[model samples]
Target: MRAFLKKEWLEWSRTGRFLVLLLVFTVFGIMNPALAKLTPWLVEIMSESLTDMGLVASEVTVDAMDSWVQFYKNIPMALIIFVLVCSGSFTGEYEKGTFIPVVTKGLSRRKILAAKALLLYGMWTVMYGLCFGITYGYNEYFWDNSIAGHLFAAAACTWLFGVWVIGLLICFSAFAKSSSQVLLGTGGVAMGVYLLGMFPKLASFLPAKLMEGLALLQQVCEVEDYIASAVTSGLLVFLCMCMAVVCFDRKQL
Candidate 1:
C-alpha cells in the first residue's frame, strides 16, 4: 500500500495538474471572501445606475454567511473541474497499456485501487484545508471572529460530500472503459441522488443537504438537522469505496 501510494504521488507530481488544481481552488477560497465583501458595493453601484435610468432599487445586504455560501456553492463547480481533470487518472493508463507493467509485477489490484482512493482523498483534503484557512483568515481580518455556531459543521458536511463524490467517481470509473464515460456516469449518479433529495421529507436523510442546507447552519437549523445527512453521506462513501474495490477486482485490465 505504501509503495502504491508513493507511485501515485510520483505520477501526480510529474503531471503537475495537482499543483494547478491547488492554485485554482485556493483562488476560489480567496475570491469567496472578497466577493462577500464586495457584493454590497457592487449592488449599490448597480442601484445607482438604475436610479440614473429613473428606476428604483431596494435595500441589499451582505454578511459573513454570504461569504461561506459563496465558498460552498463554488466548491461544487471546482469539484467538477477537478473530476474532469482526474477522470483519466486510471483510464488513460489502461488505454495506453501502461498499467500492465505495474500490474504484471504482482501489485495487488486492491492495493492499486486503495492507493488511488487515498491519494485523491488526500488531495481533496489538502485543497479544502487551504480554502478554509484562507477563508477563515480573511473572515477574521475583515469580519467578526465569532462565526455562526453551525458554520464549521456546514463546512465539515461539504467536505464529506466531496469525499462521497470521489468515491462515486472511483466506482463509476471501474465500469467505464473511457474517461468521459466515467465522468458522465458519476455525474449522473450524483444528480440522480440530488434530485431524489429534493423531496421535502428527504432533506434530513440526503447527502444533498451537505451541499445545500449545511451552508445555512448558521441560520435556523439545529445541529441534528445536519447530523443525519452527514452520517448518511459517510455510509454512502464507504459503500462506494467497497463497490469500487469489488468492481475493479473483477474487472479485466
Candidate 2:
C-alpha cells in the first residue's frame, strides 16, 4: 500500500493536479479575505451607478463571516475540478488497457479502488488544510476571529461532500468504459443533487446541505441541523465505495 500510494502521489505530481490544487486553494485563501474586504467597496461603486437608475443598493457589511461565505460559495468550482481529476483515475487505465497487467500480476482490484478514493480525499485534506490555515490567518488579521462554535464541524461537512464526489468518481470509473462516460455520470449526478436542493423539505436531509453549511459556520444555523445531512453524506460515500468495489470486481480487465 505504501508503494501504491507513493506511485499515485508521483503520478499526481507529474500530471500537475497537485500543483493546481495547491495554487487554486492558495489563491482562494487569499481571495476570501481580499474579497470580503473589497465587497463593501464594490457595492459602493455600483451603488452610485444604480442610484441613477432608481435602484437602491442595499447595505452590505464585510466581516469574518464573509470570508467563510467566499469559501463556501467557491466550493462548486473546486468540486467540478475534483470530479474531472478523479474521474479519469481508472477509466484511463481501463481505456488504455494499462490496468490489466496490474490485475494480472495479482494486485487486487479492490485495493486499487480504495487507494484511489482515499488518496483523492487525502489530497483534498491537504489542500483544504492549507486553504483553511491561510484564510483563518487573514480573517484574524483583517477582522475579529472570534467565530461561533462548531466551525470545524461545519467545515467537515463540506469535506465530507468532497468524499462523496470522490466515491462517485471511483464508482463511475469502475463501471464506465471511457473517461468521458465517467465524467458525465458523476457530473449528471451532481447536477441532479443541485436540482433536488431547491426543495426545502428534502434539502435538509440531503448531502447537498453539506456544501451549504456556511450558515452553520456563521452560527445562524444550529449545529444540530447538520446532523442528518452529515449522516446522509457519509452513507452515500460508503455506498459508493462499496458499489465501486463490487462493480470493479466483476468488470473484465
Candidate 3:
C-alpha cells in the first residue's frame, strides 16, 4: 500500500498533476478575496463610464460575504478541474494495461482501487487546505472574517463534497473504458444528483447542499438544514468506493 501510494505521489508530481491542481486552487484562493476587495473599485470605474450614458448605477456593495461568495463560486470550478484531472485515474491504467501484472503479482484489485481513490482524496485534502488557508488569510487581512461564522464547518462540507466526487470518479473510472466514458459517467451522475436539489425535501439529503458553503457561514441556513446531506454524502462516498471495488473485482483488467 505504501509503495502504491508513493508511486502515485511520484507520478502526480512527474505528470504535473500535483502542480496543476495546486495552481488552479491557489489562484482561486488568492483571487477570491482580491476580487472582493477590488470589485467596489471596478464597479465605481464602470459607473463613471456609465454616467456619460445617463445611466444611474446602483450602489456597489462589497463585504466579507462577497469574498465568501467568490469562494463558493470558485469551488465548483475547482472541483470540476479536479474531476477532469482524475477522470483518467483508472482509465489510463486500464488503457495502458499497466495494472494487469500488478494484480497478477499479488496486489488485490480492491487494494489498487482503494489506493487510487485514497490518493486522489488525500491530494484534494491538501490542496483544499492550502486554498482555504490562503483565502482565509487574505479575507481576514482585507475584511472582517467574523461576519462569516462556521468558517471551517462550511469548508468541511465542501471538502466532504470533494471526497464524494473523488469516489465517484474512481467508481466511474472502473466501469468506463476510456477517459471520455469516465467523464460522461461521473458528469451524468453529478447532474442527476444536482437536479434532485430542486425538490425541497430532497435537497436536504442531496450532496448538492454542500455547495452552499457561503449560505452556511452567513447563518442564512441553519446547520440542521444540511447536516443530513453531509452525513448522506459521506455515506455515498463510502458506498461508491465499495462499489468500485466490487466492480473492479469482476472487471477483466
After superposing candidate 2 on the true structure, give the runs of residues whose Cα lies further than 4 Å from its correct spot.
Answer: 41-61, 147-149
lDDT by residue (tens digit), candidate 2, 121-234: 888888877887888899989887677456788778888888777778888888899889988898899779878989999998888888866777767788788888888888
The residue pairs that clash in candidate 1, if any, are: none
Candidate 1: tens digits of C-alpha lDDT, residues 1-253: 7987887888888898788888888899899999999987888889978999999888777666677777777888888888887898889877987767888999888888888888889898898888888887888788863655577777777888888888888898776799989998989988998998879898789888888643355667766777888898889999988888888888887
Q: In terms of TM-score, how similar is model 3 to the real structure? A: 0.96
- On lDDT, who's better, 2 or 3? 3
- Using TM-score, give the best candidate's number: 3
Model 1, residue 20: distance off in Å is 1.7
Task: Indicate whether candidate 1 or candidate 3 has the larger TM-score.
Answer: 3
Candidate 3 segments whose C-alpha is farther than 4 A from its true place = 58-61
What TM-score goes with each of the models? 0.92, 0.89, 0.96
lDDT at position 102, candidate 1 = 81
Q: lDDT of model 1 at residue 160?
A: 83
